[model samples]
Target chain A: MRALSRETTALTLLLAPVTLFLAIFFLIPLGIMAVYSLLEPGLYGGVEWSFYHWNYGRILGWADGFIEEFDIVYLQVLGRSMGLAALTVISTLLICFPVAFWISRLPAKQKNFFIFLITLPFFTSMIVRLYAWVLILRDSGFANQLLEWLGLISEPLDLMFTGTAVIIGMVYIFIPFMFLPIYSSIEKLDMSLVQASQDLGASPFTTFRRIVLPSVMPGVIAGCILVFIPSLGNFVVPDLLGGARVVMIGNLVEQQFLYARNWPFGAALSMVIIAVMMLLMAVYLFRVVKADSNR
Target chain B: MNRSLGKTLLTGYGWLFFLFLYAPVALIVIYSFNANPINVMTWKGFTWDWYVGLFGGATTVSESSLYVDSTDQLLDALLTSLKVAFSATVIATVMGTCAALAMARYRFRFKGFYQALLFVPMVMPDIVLGIALLIFFVGAGISLGSTSIVIGHCTFLTSYVFIVVSARLAGMNPLVEAASADLGANEWVTFRRITLPLILPGVIGGALLSFIISMDDLVITYFISGVDSTTLPVYILSMIRRGIKPEINAIATLMLLFSIAIAAAGIYFKSRNTAQ
Candidate 1:
């Protein structure tokens, strides 16, 4: 009895705090946020205790003839966020394809150095990085001043506070997230397989399409999902670089809780974002499971 | 000749890719020493005046630029960040390491359930996580402050530490522990003399990484932070909302250097563990 009690005590001491802390802070909060989404947004702030689907209805554009007639405003922001995420993923893959291949081809010593250089920026804060673009892209900024000096354009272009600027910032931020995974798969790639394919008389483009592309598709998909997920919820980039002219789901959530003080509505917006993420995760999980079962 | 052509093409593409990656950071370093304090692009003259102005409270051009975020407040925010990072790192490291060890060394009931639940923090969007935590705190009647920020941080950070430490544990051979037990050592004794020393690298690496993440955090901290508990990143976000200033560039440059050093140290420790 004493030994059994002691073993239980040891296990409890080791695991209980983490379990309890997560339950209280993580699980409980997620549950509450979900619950709040189902409740009405109070007149001023806080929430109404009565059960309400109106918050979700407004965000999802299925508002049940309640006060507002199916506002598409929030839906547009969600679409914008999704569009930006898709663009960031595509652009990153295009830029990274050549780089990933090149890095994998490097001599062992140089390979580590190049990988380090790529990932070093990722360790820094996103806010600071986005601010750097502000310096470069702002009117009277570096690009404009240089163009003026070279007589490239008569007037400084309206570069900042635009959708183009937001995409540029997000792609810059996300490229590494795309690069490293693809590089990992590329590094581990068997060069002999490609050489064999070539010996079998396949052209370079054909070899890439039939062999190299198929092999690294997993990493490519992984990178896309990684970039897409964060960029979708990315509040900082659109808020700082894109300015008020651009409002994504992240910004709308921020306005609700921080600016508008509408907790219920904020919770609803959060649910929509979570739903999109969960849908993506379900697809990702399905793929992983299918691949594992096939193997 | 075809091979050479390919090599040159690749080299050119590689340089552009690297330049794209480092351009933003490189510009910050250059503009921190820029002459024009407000407009970071236009160079009036080279001066260490921003560096001076940061400490002594004066700009390169004028005494009162009005929009220059107070360096004193920035420093205060830095301290708050340091304090929060220190607390969250310590707590998360202990809980996460313990969980890592338990999950690795022992078989227990409900292990699969615990495993899935732990990773919820990593995959969940920060925006959703932040709002959820905020609503949670309000619902629970816990006043928002440094404590809330630390809680929010710990929620995610513990999982990160768990991952790092668990990777270390996974690679480690279980026979060492079996050998220690065969010599008549108790569980505590074996863990202390054998297991703990082996996994110390993971613990240290996880601690360092968690500290950096806690500091780098903005979205979670922003929602949970009170006026008195504004972290450096949160402060920077607010400053940018107001307007651009060169002092921010200077501070950002310093933070970049600081994070690189810490991350380099963490990688070193992580690599050292894998080598063994």
Candidate 2:
């Protein structure tokens, strides 16, 4: 009984601050948002508790009040967001793989220098880094100037306010994130297995296909999830580089709060996005947990 | 021969990727020295005027040369940003370290739930968290501005600090603390002498990272920041909204170099400690 009391005391003391912090900030706030999402916006953008409406339903449905014509705008933005995220993941993988391989292959004495160089860029603020992209992609930027000097184009191309520029910004921001995971995974991998496979008459390509890929698949997946999720919900990158032409779910949420001044509708939209993210997290956790158990 | 060719190609592409990553930063730093702002493409001549101009009359300038002229009030915003980020890092570090220690040392019920809950702030979209906080503040009739921004930053920054310190804590052997306790040291003494010294690197590293994230943040800052409370990034955005400026390139270059220098020192110390 004394031991039980001691354990309870320890547990209570240990958990008190964390619980209080989360309750006041994270949980209560989220709960308020949930309730607010269901409430109707008042005449002056204040909450009107009694006049509840499913105006949020209209966000994902057509103006004609028909459920079947479900708002195509949300679906279109979702599709575009997913596509951009997919491209970013592929590009990150392609770039990070060779870099990771090279770093892993380097002698331990020189490896720190290589890692330092890669991480140097990461120490800078991300906004500063993205702003550099603006300078690079501008009509008078270096990219156009180089092309013009090389006679590749007679005039500067409009690269600044395009979907392509958004992708460029995303890839630039996420490359380090992808690289760190893959690099760590590659570093942890035992190299002797590959050598043994070669000794067994396995070709280099076959060895890489069968062994190297599987060994680092977790890193790839982690990298993909990290890059993909952030980019999908990204508002700043799309807004700044995509020139207000491209809109992601994040921008939609921002508009709901600022421009539209519809709190409940914004809350509903945020809730939907959160639900989607939670679903993705559940699926990922299931796979990871299952894989760990198998291992 | 084919294998060699493949290796060469791979290595070439790797270099190309490096160029892609570094080129923009390099260009920005170079252009900060430009004598003229009208022709952004060419180097009319090298000048130290921008650097001199940045520090000399930052307060009196009609507008920042970096962004639109409308952002003349951006210096005050930058100062507010520094103040908020520094305070957030300190508060979060202390809170995070305590939480990390408690989680690491004591095994208890709902441990998994607590951990998952703690990590939610890190992964949830900024928009969700930001708007939620805004709603909560408004519901409570609290005014939105610097206080809200600091609270919002601390919410996520604390979790990040906790994660970093917890990773370090897990790697640490408990025997040292046990030994200190056996030597008649009290709990606080044991912690201060044994655990704190060992985890200081992780604490500093996490604090540095939090500082960077807080400085760079936009999404949450945008939601909660008032007209009077513009962060540097928000200021830059408003500047960009009006139009581009040559001074922005200068600002970017300076911020980049400052961070790099700090990171280099941090990494050097960390690697040196590990070597010992």
Candidate 3:
């Protein structure tokens, strides 16, 4: 009985601090934000204590037409954000899948070295990486200078402040996030299965479709989730590279808090983002559970 | 012949991929030394004026006027970043290590729930967490400043430390603890003498990672930081928004070196632990 009591005491001592800290800082803050989303915005900068559903109604097209009118811009921005994030996912998967395969086939020493090279950029400052893109894509930037020197064109291409620039920046910064998972999955791939498929007179495309794609689907899904979540909420890339042209949902949330001072409305926008994130996580979890059951 | 040709094509593509990853960074490093005052992209004679100007030293290039009003604000931001990173890292490492130990060694009813709960902060969208913390602080009457940033950081950083320490603890054998108990050592002694030394490398690694992440964190800090408590990354961000200057390249190069050095050290410790 004494020993059991002592063990329990130790466990309590170990668990208490994190539980308390997270409860006060993490869970309570989210709960309060959720509550604030349903509160009325004051005339100036603060929120009123009265209940208000118009904050979300403004986004979802239920505005009463007296005080708040439904603006389609918010929904458009949300859709654009999702669309850009999906494009980033597809681009990163295409860029990383072949490279992951190439790296997996390398000898052990070179493989580790290449993996180190891939992960090294992730440790660098994100702002610095984004700034590099600004230098490359600006009107008086490297790409324009190089093209002019090559006598290809007299005019500078409008690369910066475009959706293409934003996508490139997103893909550059998120390569490691996508690469590591795909590489791990590729490393575990069985070469003999590919050989057997080929021996059975399957075409190269057919073999890849039959054997390789199924094996790496989990990693692709994991990588997509990892890349898509951050891309969906990104403001910095669009701010620097997209300029004022491409506005994402994250920038909208920022404007609501910093410029508009509509705290309740900002809270509402955040709740929508949380909703999307939760939905994606639920889908991913369900797929994983199903995969495990099948196994 | 077809297979060999395919292999060669794959090898070339792989190298090009790496070049795409690194060339932009290389451009920044090289251009920081260029003496072009108006356009940073154009190549001019090499000079160390930008690097010299970053430290408040006088530069010979009169055309490249310094964009920063004063270097003191930059130094102040750096100091704030270090202070926040240090305090947050210490608190997070302790709490996370303790939590990892409890989860690994004990059979608790909410074990699965706690594990999932920890992942929520990590996977939550940064903007959502930022706004949530912003609302919470204002509503709770907690002022926005270094204290709030530290608290905000710990909410997520503790999860990172927990993961690293938990990985270390998972690879360890519990029989050693049992052996220590059999030899009449109390739990405290066993933990101090047996477990801590074994996990010291991981603890150090986790601390280093949290410190780097805390220093680099901008999104959450942007929403919660007080007017005077700007961090280094946030400072750089504001500078970029204002205008591009040669000094930014110098600062960025230095930051890149610092981050790489710390990450290399963390990887070294991790590799050494694995080798053992």
Candidate 4:
């Protein structure tokens, strides 16, 4: 009984610091945001005392039976956010899987080098890389110059500040993130099973579909989540590459709190995004746990 | 023959993927040497102009040149970034290691709850955390500056440190602890001598991870950083918005090389470990 009490004391004492730090700095701020979402906008900087659901109503376009009062602009923004995130997840998965599979197939001595190369770019500051892409994709940039030099086009292509540019940037930077997880999964796969399937007269495609894909599905799901969540909330690519032409959920939330001074609305939008993220986490954890149970 | 053909195709595909990956970073490194006083597209003859300009060396600027930062301001921003990163990493690594010990060594009630709470900071959107912290600080009447930046960073970084250290702890040999107890060492003494030493590598790895994350962080630092506390990324971000100069490219290349050297060392160690 005494030893158990001592253990509990040690645990409490040890856990206290992080718990307190997180509570004060992280949890309290989020708690404040939760409350702020319901409160009306302040005259200047803070939220007013009165309760208001108008902020969320405005975001979700809940018209109080008045058709003209409705605006689905932010909802569409939310849709765009989802669409872009899904696009990033799917494309990154498709591209990185082949890359991961290739790396996994390499001779054992060389495999680490290939994996390391994929992730090295992720260590560099993204702002610098994106700026470099601007140098490549801008008017009179490398792409345009090359095209013109090749006699493929008479004029410089206007590629910068386009949605395509944002997607391109997202895919490029997110490749390692998607690749590493998938690579780790495939690297650990029972290759003998793959060989067995091949030796049983199964076609390559049939072998891959039955053995390879199922074995690496965990990594694929993980890669998809890793890419999808950040892409959904990404403000940098859209802000820098998309310029003013495109706006995602992150950008809109930033605008509200900073420029528009609509704290409640911004808080509401964030809460919604946070809710969506929480739901995704729950789904992912549930799926992973179920997979673990089956195994 | 078919297997060899397949291997060749896979190697080609790997090269293509890598080319796509490294092109932008390589462009920055290459162009940093170009004496393109104007746009980077117009590649002037190779010169040490930009690197010299990044240092305190004198540069002859034409009338048409955009604004340039002196080494003083750029160094100030770099120092601030280093300071914030170091301070945040220390705090997160210390507190996180302690909490990780608790989780690893004891069976506590509401363990999952605390774990989830820590993870929320990691997975939550930076924008959400940025604005949320902004409003929180503003409401709390805490002035936005270096101190707030440290706290803001610690909030999210603690989670990462916790994850890294706890993973190490979970894999640790339990018999070592039993041996320490059998030897009649007190709890604190055993922890100091055995557990802490055992987890030191994890602590260092977590610290490095935290340091990089803190340095790379822009959005949270941007929202919270005051006029005097602008970090390197923030300064560079502002510069890019106005216009990027070749000197900025030089600085970026240097930063890239620094990180690349560190990554190379990490990869060497990682591969050695895997081989063992």
Candidate 5:
């Protein structure tokens, strides 16, 4: 009995600080945000204590017309954010998948070196990386300079502030997130299965479709989720690269808070992002649990 | 012949892949030394004027050429970043290490739930967390500043430390701890002598990682950092928004080196622990 009590005491001591800290800081803040999403916006910069559903109604196209007219623009921004995030995921997957395969086939020493090179950017300042894109995509930037020096065109391309620039920036910064998972999955792929499929007279494409795709699907899904979530709520890339042209949902949320001072509306926009994140997580969890049970 | 051709193609593609990953970074590093103050993209004679100017040293460059309004503001932001990262790292490391020990050693009810709860903060969107913290701080009457930033960082940083420490704890041999207990050492003594020493590398690595992350964190800090308490990244962001300058290139290059050095150290410790 005394030993059991001592064990309990030790467990309590170990867990108490994190639990309390997370409760006060993490859970409470999130809970307050959820509450604020439903609260009324004040005239100036703060929120009123009164209940208001129109903050969300503004985004969902059910605003009370008198005070707040529903704006399809918010919904369009949300859709654009998701669309861009999806494009980023697809582009990163396409770019990393073959590279991951190539790396997986390399000698172990070279493989580690390459992996280190890939992950090095992840450790660097995100702003610095984005700034690099700003330099490359600006009108008087390296891309234009290089093209002009090549005698390809006299005119500079309108690259910066385009959706293409935003996607490129997102893909550049998020390569490691997509690469690591796909590389690990490719490393675990069974060469014997591929050989067997090929031996059965399957074409290379057929064998890959039959054997490799299924094996790497988990990693692809995981990489997509990792890339997509950050991309979905990414304000910095769109703000820096997209400028005033390609506004994403994250920018809308930022404007609401910083410029508009509509805290409740900003909170509402954030909740939309949270909703999408939770849904995706739920699907991923369900798939994982199912996979585990099948195994 | 087809297989050999495919192999060559893949090899070439791999090199291109790496080039894509690294070219932008290389461009920034090379251009940092370029003397073109008007257009940073154009190649000019190499000079360290930008780097020299960053440290408040006199440069041949005219005052109109320099974009930064004040070096004092830049230094103040750096100081704020260092302060926030240090305090956040210390608090997060302790809490995370403790939680990791409890979770790894104890088989308790709701263990899965607790683990999931910890992960939510990590996977939650940074914007959501930033706004949530902002609302919470303002509503709770807690002033937003370094204190709030530290608190905000610890919320997620503890989870990172927890993961790193837990991985270390997982790899450890339980028999040594049992042996210490059997040799009449109490739980506390066994933990101090056996577990703590074993996990020291992981703890240090976790601390370094959290420190780097805290220093680099912008989105959350942007929302929560009140007037006059901006960190380095937030300050640099404002600079970039105002205009591109040669000095930013110098600052970025320095930041890149600083982060790479700390990250390399952290990875060294991690790899050493795993190798053991």
Candidate 6:
């Protein structure tokens, strides 16, 4: 018992700096944001503590101010954001799944180098990656040039600053993220189980569906969370590639704080984003835990 | 009945995926050799002029003056980025390793909460964290600049290093340490000699990961950075705003090669260590 106490005391001493650091820098700032979200901004860019209003509530459609020009515009924005995030996830998965499966099947000698190639681009500036997409998707850019060269189109297509461009950019940036987790899962799967399924008269697709998919489902779920969360909150890709025409939830929050100077409203938007993310994380964790226990 | 066919299909799918991943990067590298900087897509002809120009004289060679032109600004931003990433990685690594050791060795009540709290920066939207930190700094009367950005990065990156180190510690049996102690070493000495060595590789890996993340980070750096404190990504963002540059492509291609080289080295060393 004394030894345990000594060990714990030593541990506490070790953790003290980091604990204080997080408490001051992380939790405290988040708390301040939460507090700032509650108060209304005053006449001269100052927050008035007394003006208790739920301007944020109007956005979620949980409350109407009962007198002002409140509407469901925020809800529409939320819907738009969720739709974009969902599309990003679906596209990323579509591109990444086959890639991950293919990479995992490589001879052990060549596998690391293959993974290395996939991950190499990620180390470059993400803004550059998105900008490259801009360079490609622009009307007079590479995509158009290639099409024109192949005699496919007489005129350059108006591809930039659209929803499709944003999705493509998101997929380009995040496919590696999705690929790694699924690849890891696939690599870890028991080969004997797969062989057994084949021997038991299961076709390749059936074996994949019943045996392979189940084993890799955790990775798939993780990949989904990894892709979805960032894609949902991503401000850069849409801002640059989509030309700020598309209103993602991330952009909405940025506008509130920086451009609109609506601190409380931005805070509310952020809180909604946080709440949704937390809820999704909770469901994911629950599913993962359930899956783990069953395994 | 169809194992060979299945294998063939999987192989095809894999190569196709690799092609997709590599094509853009390859395109960027290839296009850097174009004679015309503005026409990146339609290659007129290949030329070594750009590479020569990169070193020879100036970013802007005015017809009047030859000596005044410079790539100094871009070079400065790249250097600043390296400094910030290195600083953030080192600070985060040390603090994070300590925190991980604490969590691993201790039977603390709030350990789970601590673990969850560490994940906030990594999982939270960068823009929000950036703004929250911006507000916090403003409220605290701390001046905004590179230091604030570094502190913000360290806050989250420390968590990353901590998580990585903790996982390593957990996977590492405690019995080795106990045996070391039984052989008559103090806690500090034991950690220095045995524990730290065992976890050093993980610590280095975590540090490298943090360095890459800090270097790649845009959102937080954008909000926190002062007018003069632009990292390479922030610089690239500003440049993109101005318009595309062939030099930017050249810079990107160089950066790409640097990253790939580092990643390859990391993989090589990591595998070599495991093979032993």
Off by over 4 Å in 3: none
* Best candidate (score: DockQ): 5
lDDT by residue (A110-223, candidate 1, tens digit) is 988898888777778878888889888888888898888999998999998888888999999888889988998887778899999999999999999998986787788889
The sequence of per-residue lDDT tens digits that candidate 2 reaches over residues A170-218 is 9998888899889998987888999999999998899998888888877
In candidate 6, stretches whose alpha carbon ends up further than 4 angstroms from where it belongs are A1-5, A62-68, A202-206, B1-3, B47-56, B59-70
**Where in model 5 is the C-alpha error above 4 Å?**
none
How displaced is residue A92 in candidate 4, in Å? Answer: 1.0
Clashing residue pairs, backbone N/CA/C < 3 A, model 1: none
lDDT of 3 by residue, A1-295 (tens): 9989988999999999999999999999999999989999999989889999999999999998887878999999999999999999999999999999999999999998999999989788899999999999999999999999999979999999988898999999999989999999899899999999999999999999999988888888899999999999988899899888999999999999999999889889988888898899889989966885798
DockQ (Cα-based) for each candidate? 0.77, 0.64, 0.83, 0.77, 0.85, 0.63
Clashes of 2: 3
Which 10 consecutive positions of candidate 2 chain A have the poorest summed lDDT? A61-70
What would the per-residue lDDT of candidate 5 be over residues A1-295, giving only the tens digit for each residue? 9999999999999999988899899998888989889999988988889999999889998897887899999899999999999999999999999999999999999998899899888889999999999999999999999999999979999999999999999999999999999989889999999999999999999999989998888898889999999999999999999988999999999999989999999999999999999999999989966785787
Highest lDDT against the true fold, candidate: 5
lDDT of 2: 0.80
lDDT of 1 by residue, B1-276 (tens): 499999999989999999888887888988888787666777767877777776765544676553444567877889999999999999999999999987886677989988988887987889889989888887788898889999999999999999999988887889999999999999999999999998899899889989998999999999889768899999988987877777777888888899899879967986787688
Candidate 5 matches the true fold with a TM-score of: 0.98
DockQ score for model 1? 0.77
Per-residue accuracy of model 4 over A202-262 as CA lDDT, tens digit each: 9999999999888888888888888887888888888888888878898898888778888
Per-residue CA lDDT of candidate 4, range B26-135, in tens?
A: 88888888877888767888878777777867666552453454678889889999999999999999998988888888887888898888777887888889988998
Q: Estimate each model's TM-score.
A: 0.96, 0.93, 0.98, 0.95, 0.98, 0.92
Residues B150-258, candidate 2: write the lDDT tens digits: 8889889989889988988988889988899889997668877888989988888888878888988888898889778889888877766666666776777778877
Off by over 4 Å in 1: A1-9, B57-60, B66-70
Q: Report the error of model 2 at residue B101, Å.
A: 0.5
Local distance difference test values of all predictions, in order? 0.86, 0.80, 0.91, 0.84, 0.93, 0.80
Worst 10 residues of 6 chain B by lDDT: B59-68
The backbone clash count of each candidate, in order, is 0, 3, 0, 0, 0, 0
Candidate 4's docking class is: medium
Ranking by lDDT: 5, 3, 1, 4, 2, 6
RMSD of each: 1.9, 2.7, 1.3, 2.1, 1.2, 2.8
